[model samples]
Target: MELLEGNESRCQNMFWMNKDVFIRLCDELENIYKVKGSQRISVAEKLGMFLYTLGEGAGNRNVQERFQHFGKTVSRYFSGMLNVVCDMTKEFIKPSDPKFKSIPPEILGDYRYMPHFKDCIGAIDGVHVRATISPSNQVPYIGRKGIPTHNIMAVCNFDMQFTFACAGWEGTAHDTRIFQSAIHNLALKFPKPPNEYPQMKWYLGPYKCQRYHLPEFRRGAQPTGYKEIFNHAHSSIRSVIERTFGV
Candidate 1:
């Protein structure tokens, strides 16, 4: 791809003869492969795997073919690159420490609903991501867009920031189930839950923010749902998550 984009030499010069971060990353990777008796593989070959799979999202055989230009030996180099980048991103891309304090709903920016939904901390929803076909009851795995995929649940905050996401569950799972799983894993993988809500910080007005969780509404022992006045505000703000993901 670098070559396709008119930067092939940059890739070769850095990976081949230069000593830099990629080299260090490759050395660190060799140690990782060593546990599996993969010590004999070259750094370049490991890099090839990473480049082929994640960089281009190519299948294994396609990756093997792509490495032919670099000489098959460099394929392992790609694998090293993929592993290092994956490990790095997982550690880095995370939900920022979200304050319970909420902001005005103007962020929706001329979105159908406005101020009434202001106190919402973030929008939440699920989307489908392509996955390998499965053999069991095939219809459930078939997507409305006519593709084979698993229903990946993901959620974004008011800022369109991907605050939560999960992939691997079968499409059969309900939105509520997917949401619960995402939150549980997010809590364990990250920090403690906040004791307050963001809207608590925003000053009240036609555009102030408010947040409500259905589970909270149910468990709080309220025989009725939220108050009639609150019902409109909550629904308006809650739709943000689905809209953000284009669900």
Candidate 2:
């Protein structure tokens, strides 16, 4: 760091911050975060290496050698670093709840959304995530796809942004069940309490409730207006989730 500050640093060694930042961060872990364990290399070193891997995914041995350490598997480093990073970063990266607002009659013309999708609050759908189960269960766990594992329930909006995701549900679970689960598990910070997830806040503008309401979605024959409306909204939101993983 001192050499770099003096303007004598070379391009090859300019990544000195990677080391310095790592050390300082490790100091944070030890002093501020209070991780009480003896380690040869500081938490900073492992962290720097982890950040570097994010830029360029590498094999375990490859990363270990770059860190100037030995016998540390990439698996161990990934497990530790990600566990901490996810815990620290999820609140910031994930999307907040949805809301219900009115839409402008001018924008909708006769239908909704001038010509595009109008009054469409959002779309919601569920997905399947394959898991690696044991021998016997693997066969059944593989839904219609004939693969392995179960399904993950995910939801999104008409604009194609994903608002929520619920993984690890069995494939046999219903879409409404997945919708209910997503709402129940949703963080309450962005939403008002009375209803689980935030309702659309506007009837016009961006807040108009434009749900995807697929025809096949409400299969059980509940036949209620609100249930149908919610199912449609969930369906629309779910369409986005489907397209997301498709990429």
Candidate 3:
């Protein structure tokens, strides 16, 4: 209550978003998701508790102390909030244009990638998220990072919204394997580019063993040849997925 009623900075600091967004989220949860408030607790308080735990990575005890509630109460609302948010993914995390009818504004408006990457639809990449599994079964989930994690493959348009996501793959699984599995799985309904262009390619990758990373070219090492120039442009355009993952 205090956090939401307080200034914008306090709400942003604790909830990881401003007061208006927080209130709007609470409203959406109640109106659309049918989340209800109990006799003693309001919906905003429940949501604030959930956001505090997530934004701070705080444990149940920390949430209990901060929210002034019992451990069980905090656990119940946190789990409820988590489930509600997951359900919302179906509604929010999708391509703005299901048909891929035209080029995205983010790409169309940018002269650097217009003509060259005209056929490019979006970016695809994989990220490793830490996972908790039994010690006996940890080997399969341990990748080059030497940690148990999940390799999540996701596709996002230039606007930085996830159109598709394939999770639950072990960290050791190769990106190609996960990608192939995702495309082959009809149930996933992965978006496919329209056939307007007969020479539609699945994806474009940088030149092999070449200067690709953005930092490499940023340090006064300008791309010299055609391959290096193409790779540099490709990396610059495809960096949206990297930024999305960073967020």
RMSD (Å) of each candidate, 1 decimal: 10.4, 10.0, 3.2
Put down candidate 2 lDDT per residue, 1-247, tens digits, no spaces. 3432454333124333444554566676667556434356545455555665655555567777766656455567667877776555444434443453543343355342344444444444456665656687665566677777456654444445555455666666666666555555536232222243356332112123433346654545443465455545444434555677686
Cα TM-score per model:
0.52, 0.45, 0.82
Q: Which number leads on TM-score?
A: 3
lDDT of 2 at 198: 51
Ranking by lDDT: 3, 1, 2
Overall local distance difference test of candidate 3: 0.87
lDDT of 2: 0.52
In TM-score terms, candidate 3 sits at 0.82
Collision count of model 3: 0
Residue 216 in model 3: lDDT: 91
Write the residue-wise lDDT of candidate 3 on 1-247 in tens digits.
7776778899999999999998899889999999999998999998888889878878889998887999999999999988998888878877788777787788788898888887788899999998877899999999999999999999988887788888899999999999878777777777767663333355678889889888999996789899999989999988999998888
Candidate achieving the largest lDDT: 3
Deviation (Å) of 41 in candidate 2 = 7.0
lDDT of 1 by residue, 11-120 (tens): 54434433355556556556753413256644545564564455455665675576553445445555545556656545544566555465534555645445545445
User: What overall lDDT goes with each candidate model?
Assistant: 0.54, 0.52, 0.87
